[model samples]
Target: MITKEALERVRGWFAGRLPEDWRAAPADITVDREEITVRLTIPDVDLPADTAEAEADEARAGRAKAFREETREQRMKIAQEAQHRYERKVSWGVSVGGREELWTHVSAPVMTRLRQPQRLVLDTLVEAGVARSRSEALAWCVRLVGQHEDEWLGELREAMGHVADVRRKGPAA
Candidate 1:
C-alpha cells in the first residue's frame, strides 16, 4: 500500500507541471484491498501568446480546440503504448497436471494473445468437471489446443474416447 504522503507528492508534481489550458488533470487516488493506486492524466498546453492571441478571440478558440484534439490523440497513443508495456510485463501462469506428472507452466506475453471467449469456455469446462481444474484446463487449452478451439475439443474428445476404451478393455483381458 502506498502512503498518503507519497500519493500527494505525485499529485503535487503533476499539478505544478501541467499547463493551464488542461482544464482538469487532477490525480485520482483509489484504494483497492490493501493497495493504493493513482491515475494521472497529462495536461494540454495552452495556446501560444503570439499576435494570433491578440487577434479575434475566435482564432484563439480554434487553436485551443485544435490543441485539445491533438492532446486527446496523444493521450490515446500513450495509453496504448503503456497497455502494450503492461501486457508484456504481467505474468499470467498456466500449469498442467498434478504433482509427479508432466506440468507445463506458461507465462507473460504468451497469455494475453489468447482469445477471450475460448479462454472463458475452457474455464467454464474446468468448473463443469469436463477438465480437471482451472490451471489444468488453461494449460491444456493454451499448449495442447491450437488456435482452432473446436478442432482441439474434438481431439480431446477422441483422447477421452481412447481412455474410456482402455478402461473397458482392461490390461488382463
Candidate 2:
C-alpha cells in the first residue's frame, strides 16, 4: 500500500508536470505498487442537444481518439520520465463529456496460492464459460466483489490508512 504522503507527492508531481491545456480539470491519479494511472477530463465536443445517442457516443469516441493521437508523443515522454522517477509504469486515459477511454496500459500478472475449495470455485467459473481460465475466473470474482462491496472496501481502506498513520507515530523500534 502507498503511504498517503507518498500518494499526494505523486499526484502533485503529475499536476505540475502535465500541460495546463491538456485537462479541463485536475487529473484523477491512482497509484499502486505496480503502476500509476492518470485520468484527465478533456473538453467535450459541441453538438446539438437533439443528436442521437449513438451519434453522440461516436463523436465522443472520435474526440478521444484524436486527443490520444495528437498527444501520443508528448504523453510518452512524460510517462517515460514519470516511470523512471517513480519506478512504476504510468498509464494515461481521458474522459470527454460522459465517455471515458483508456490508452495502452500495463496489465501486471499476479501469482496466488489457493486451497482446493478456491480452486474448485475457479474451475466452476471456467466450466460455466464465465471465464477462460483460473486467472480470469479469479479476476472476475475480484471485480464482482469490488462492484458489490465498494462502500465497505472504501471504509476498510480508510481504516488501513489510519492504522498506517498510527504506526508512523509510534516510538522508533
lDDT to native, each model: 0.45, 0.94
Error of 1 at 39 (Å): 5.6
- Best-performing candidate as measured by TM-score: 2
lDDT of 1 by residue, 26-126 (tens): 54433322222334333333445564633535554444445445655544454344335333211111111110111111232324455888678777988
Q: What is the TM-score of candidate 1?
A: 0.25
- Positional deviation of residue 24's Cα in model 2 after best superposition, in angstroms: 1.6
RMSD over all Cα atoms, model 2 = 1.3
Q: Provide C-alpha RMSD values for all models, in order.
A: 22.2, 1.3
Model 2 global lDDT (CA atoms, 0 to 1) = 0.94
- Candidate 2, residues 1-173, lDDT tens digits: the string is 88888899999999999999999999999899999999999999899999999999999999999999999999999999999999999999999998988877788899999999999999999999999999999999999999999999989988888888999999999
